[model samples]
Target chain A: MRMLRLLTVIMLLFSVAPTITAQETITVDFYFPTATATITNPEAGESIEAVFNRYAAAFEAANPGVQINVVYTGSYTDTRNTIQTEIAGGGAGPDVAVMLTTDLFSFIEEGTILPVQDFIDTMPDGEAYVADFFPAFLLNSLDEEGVIWSIPYQRSTPVLYYNVEQFAEAGFDAPPRNRQELAEMAQALTLPDGQRWGVWLPTEGFPIWLFSAFVIADGQHFVEESPSEVYFNTPQTREALDYIISLSRDYGVMPGGTLSWGDGPSIFTSGKASMLFHTTGSLTRILNEAPFEVGVAFLPSGTAGEDGTGYGAPTGGGNLYLFANSTPEEQAAAWAWIQFLSSPEIQSDWGAATGYVAARRSAWELDPLASLVARRPQYAVARDQLAFAQKEFSAYRTIDIQGIINSTLSGIISGATTDIEGALTTAQAQIDSLLAEYR
Target chain B: MRHHNALGSRVADAVTTLLSLLWLSPLIFAILLSFRPPNEPITNGNIFFGSTITLDNYRAAWSVAPWLTHYLNSIIFVVGVLIVQLVTVTMAGYAFARMRFRGRDTLLLIILLQLMIPSGVLIVQNFATIRTLNLFDTHIALMLPYWGSAFGLLLMRQTFREIPFELEEAARIDGASLWQVLRHVYIPLSIPAYTAFALVSISSHWNEFLWPFIVTRSESVRPLTVGLSKLVATTDVGALYNQLMAGTLLVIAPLVILFMFFQRRFIESFARSGLK
Candidate 1:
């Protein structure tokens, strides 16, 4: 009886003890820029978590010594701010970060991110695989100093999403091919009883990309060879601004309540608006959730003498960056994960899973997705827009000045001051003041 | 006319009850949401209208972080803070009530000034102080700044003054020292006041998020408030809503249970202490 009781106590002790005594797993911290989303017991290839799980399983299976822990911090901006603070404080931050290349230049200048070329050079198949990505995607991933930094994983550009029913109602067989057609179609599409507008722009968050495209389309320069100095005060930019403003005030074809925090895509999806100018990444969301049939159109053309023949959108996507602080072995492991993730198969699978266009050119040739893209046909518009896309080369203190741009852009739309020159002047002055520290 | 008066009063009573319920509706919704499945999207249809519920949210909430550790750390923080506060406030209250000293009224007024100044503006300064003391990332860091509360001192002073001087005189006649007089008579009589202060201090510290989030880096030291933020940030409507709601429910469950357990004592102490 005594022996049995002693045995039972020993068993209890053994069961309660932590199992960290063996060969410790190499924990690689992966910081993802995403807000949490709930998908119910997700089906295979149907959700982001499902795709993440597949990658994690395959990576872990290949490299048994490694255990990757994913922490969904928040949106792109939130993760950038958090990482900045963490780096400043000299704490144990993420070993790897997968975030947008739109903010890459600023992060590189601030020295928050470390270049991964040296890590890539030591890899067996890195040279060939890295070459598989499009040049534009690679350029977006490069730092201002022309050093290779992050690897492009997922990328997209904005396309015009139009309501098919509204287009038919407006007596148009297809999406408008030019700005003049779009404007004329907008006038035709506007209905009194429906109160549905023709075109809608987000009053916040997306204005920088749209404004940058406008500046480029109008043949105006933001800055000379030096990325500093304000140059957005040209006549061409003023004309572009006037055109967009007229789309709202003169045409009365833009959705109302945009200035007061209403969603443009939701408005488009719910048939409150006839058209929405947003990312191709929104394609899957609109396809999955919108109550009406949707159509894709090229971004509007500018007036003559402007580079308005084609829409000049920026290539926006998340990149996989390996941290410099990681051990040589850990770096190798992270590279392996990155390579696995960026492969043609994975890219194709991920693109099909999410709405994002794959960074790889080879992904377009894959079956089912290839067929889908070929059939829907308009999905290929993102590829064409990619040719004109430009990445942002924000100043060293882009973050502090980013909020200023977002606020000032919103201020422009609300007609708060109605002075484009004054807004640009004040923005320039603010940017200059911010740049003083970096200088 | 009698029927009309009766009908009007009944309608008035019904409207008042409805208004009370309308005020409580959000709290009721939070309670219901706490039991929802983790990761389910909440829609308008579900907001005022769904009935399918489960305990998975509660279970997920329980498992999300080192909640047991958070609860233990919270208890330690509240008890430690309360113990130190009780001693300081009692002595300070006794001094303010009985002793006529130089700058006494001026000093009390200065202390009361702390109540007027918002706590938010002091965060950066408090963080610097906590850092200087090597108390950052510790439960003590959270408790230290709030240990000697001005509000508690003022309340205790009022309660002490309400008591007659005869109690202290009786204790003095028994050859009791100043310490003994405070310990035996004054302390015993001030139970209601101390209880009122404890309820407030414990609940506030238990639910505080920002200061704790700023100070504590590790999950081990974080309180329920900071832990719940992780769950909130994770809960996008299309994913993890159930888990977020579950975690929120778990965070409040202990406090709710605690409040219920001490509801009678809480009401009595507040009533006796005369702090509405």
Candidate 2:
């Protein structure tokens, strides 16, 4: 009796399997980082997974015979690691994944990603679609040959956050516009005996990020279109490094040694630091947590340009990339899913819900975000700063190169290495050797 | 001599207390931070008592992930791994300790060599094997690679060697079967070693992140560490330390409580087994 029952079940499975394959739905395994895990919409009170599920449901509803499996890969680093491991193991990874913008070169070098340009070329409004993105946000998405590899999604830039009441108390009606004024303002706002520092420009962890702002403001960028080159030992970068060290050692506005990136916002909110150089993604959190009024402004310029705008910031965020290990139909569905997520309306909603700057220009013209920005103008500062934003330092061996730069900067700033020029020169030499293969 | 010994003991007590406090500081900080008001910064008035304590962080952290499902998955994962590890290590240990076979020492040497390689380096190969086995995104995949622990096998083999051969001989003389003699004699004598290995295996697998995160996709299969990871935002976003600490506490609460309950027994087992 048991044998007969098992035989019937096996026969049933054999009959159903063929039909299931005949009408198989195209399933796109969408792996995304939990970048927005902490972001919650106050009005809707929806959790992060809920928001993701809603989007997936909407996309699937619009396109029949297609399914989206949303996998919450931990962080940007974890998502990239998972994908790399899967691809190296000869398994089909996620059909689509959101990874750090700086991962473009490595992914391309590994040949694991499908260039989204291939899909964009087939679109009727492809040119306009590509043009709609902020150029700063797209800076890291393109390869050296000018082929697009990814689409910008959650993006951000560092901005100057000041204590409004402290500025008023110091008799400053406006935020600093130049480096000199910034130094003076920070000094005035600072209290004696370490009660409060003038500013908390964090130089720990990835110090090169905020340091890039200073280098760019001084009329140079550390990296260019070439993935194998970096200008780490340039006069501009040295001056920037010197200026950052002087902020603590000479000007006595910031604490000596390396300040932690994780502690900046809390220090600012608690009035232990008067001004903070932090990502705009923390704007909402700061605005809510701060007891005093908060003010946002462009990072003060080191060298004023002809347009009276020398402000520069490095864009930092993740981008959507289509993986290569998928069927053509699945790839098409994944591309459509990407398009839906990056569409103007979705971007606007996403920007408003989280504090991330919307990558698309038209997203700011839409509802929730437009209204929110109108009420609180601080949201627009990062977007406006994009006009001077540069690509984040990325290269073929980005992680190893970043380690060299970060450790060099940390060593100099922390007073462990006083010879900035010599250290940077050595770093440049080391980076050259590392990137020689790519060249 | 008595006075001198008393002074020496007192000094040792002081040192031990200091060392224990050093170890406990992070947990202490986490406890304080988890109870802190959500918006209150640690740099306020006092680091410890900066603001009025509240349950808000716990409330918020609890809602971020499905803790119940994660708890179930974690329990299933650790228990499942421990069970399989116990059976395999016991059988393999007996074979190496007592059973005579061709090239036994060579095979034992090969198994012991795995202890030198870090598990992280084997992720690619293990993941491929799991994929081939069609166990991706399942709890079994999360537990499979860990089932044959080289450290446990070696420890068990050494432990079985330490047991008196007279005990097994007595059991065999009483007409006990091979399985009965091994089970009632060798197993009973090596309880301390088994307990130590069980604790080591359970805690390590409980806290594992990268392997489980790579293998499982759904919440139904992912462990508590993956759930805890959801509370961490990318570098672009600021850290929410209060809620993060709260989420961490929620994830590790079970293991911490279990250890507290079995604290005495754990120490005794480790002491007897000469394992730490």
Candidate 3:
């Protein structure tokens, strides 16, 4: 009699709950870059994966029979490698993946990723969702054909990080506002005894990243915004490279070794260096880790942008792409997952939790970020710098061309080779050949 | 003279200990740094400061990815590959040592030549082959290339050759079959060689990141190395030194623990199975 009662209850539950048949279950493989495994907040190290899980749970509860698998594939580069390998190996990999915005053209060339519009155009709120992204972010997400290929996820720009105590001792009330001021200030703060160095820009980081900012501040773009023409051999570029080499070469302010982009923030916090020119993505990390008060300012402009808003720092970070190989059901599920992640509420918390600037303007008006800005204005600087922010080197083969330019710069700075013009000339020739087919 | 000799021996021990510590410094730093807090200054070159320590990094690292699945997958992957390797290597080694065969010397030369060929040189071909076999994302794909290890073949062949033929002859006279002779005589005495080979196989597979990363796309097949990297390695954000080290420590902890418990067998196996 007890067994009969249990069987009757089970039947009723199945009838009411809507039985999920195997084929009807939509499984979305969501692959994204791993930035903060834990919490991203400057004050509280929040578990980003936990937030993703919560978002996944909410989406699951609202829409029955759909499962979201949030797989944190290594770095942005790793995400690209995984996607390419799967597609080339003839396997349908993650339904959705995130990679650097500069990877758009490269993916387009591969012909593996679906345009975000493919799914967005089918949604009721598609138009508004498309319009909601900040124009600055939209600049990189859209291709030359005006078809949007990706959605801006975690975007950022480089800024100057300075030590307040070191500045006071150097007798400067304000951080340097231009290249000339930077050289003077760096000279004042420099101590040759190895305990503290003046100013250091990591030559060992990503190719064509921070140095591109200097090119923009000098009123020049490294590659044409559309990435068509070669500009490495120009006098303008040579000037920018000379100013960089002069710091260690003629000025004696920076250290003489190959410094890595990753080592910048750590070196600063350890009081090994006084100033660091690094990404605003590191703001939260520096705030949380540094024992001293940290001050941040716009990167000093070159002579061209005397007003300091000259074609500003280049933006660099991860953007979302829809995999083309997924089923219609999987794609639909992936579209829903993208919407949930890109929603204002979720993006707002994302900005506050992680140091990344929210991709949409509306997210800035939302609660925690709005309050975060009010309480700590330092958090808002990266977003404010967006007015001047330009897209990084996005070309047919972005990393390759940038690598050539980077290795050239590295040679000049490290004193391994002295002829900057000779190096740039060789790089210019390589760029011309690399871009010939693209043109 | 007695006092001087005692001092000389003490000096020699101290010198040897210092050299060992020097060789082990990077490992030591990784272990110690795992305990340090994120807020502590690690690059200031004072890694030994014990002002504050926390298990928060471990907690944070654990929550990032599915570590439980990774642990299970890694154990199954290494052990499965090792077991298959033992059987194949032992049998092949026996064939080379005792059995007469055609073109045996030429075949041995061809197999030994594989030792000079780096695994990286064949990645593209291996990947293509894996796809053709329809085993692209499976753990079996990861184990396929490594199943017939050239180094293992060489090691076992050398070990088998050192064993006396009298034992096998004695067993055969008792009317035992060839299989029975191997089971009773060769297998029992070659424990150290097998143990030594097993250690090498386990550690190599455990730490291998690149191939597993290429083959496995989902969490179901990911090993601890890939999982830990996904947890801590971010492009935009710099690594959380403590958390990264903690995750690394967690990934390496099992191997370290195993080595500690089986220190004697591990050392003896390698010493007795010294390179031919």
Best by DockQ: 2
lDDT of 1 at B150: 97
* Tens digit of per-residue lDDT, candidate 2, span B163-267: 888888998889999899878888888888888898998889889999999988898888899988878764555778888999999988988998999888889
TM-score of chain A considered alone, across all candidate predictions: 0.85, 0.95, 0.90
> Which portions of model 2 show Cα errors greater than 4 Å?
A1-14, A17-22
What is the TM-score, restricted to chain A, for candidate 2? 0.95
Give the clashing residue pairs of candidate 1, or none: A37-B239, A38-B238, A38-B239, A38-B240, B37-B242, B38-B242, B38-B243, B39-B240, B39-B242
List, residue by residue over A328-354, the lDDT tens digit for candidate 1. Answer: 667777777777788787787776666
Please list the residue runs of candidate 1 whose C-alpha ends up more than 4 Å from where it truly belongs after superposition: A1-24, A39-54, A102-106, A124-127, A154-156, A220-230, A255-262, A304-308, A364-384, A436-439, B1-276
Lowest lDDT sum, 10 consecutive residues, model 3 chain B, at B41-50
TM-score of each: 0.72, 0.96, 0.90
lDDT of 3 at A429: 94
Candidate 1 at residue A403, lDDT?
A: 68
Instruction: Give the Å error, residue B20, model 1.
Output: 7.3
Stretches off by above 4 angstroms in model 3 are: A1-20, A42-45, A118-128, A169-171, B1-15, B42-47, B53-59, B66-69, B120-145, B217-221
Residue A92 displacement in candidate 3 (angstroms): 0.8
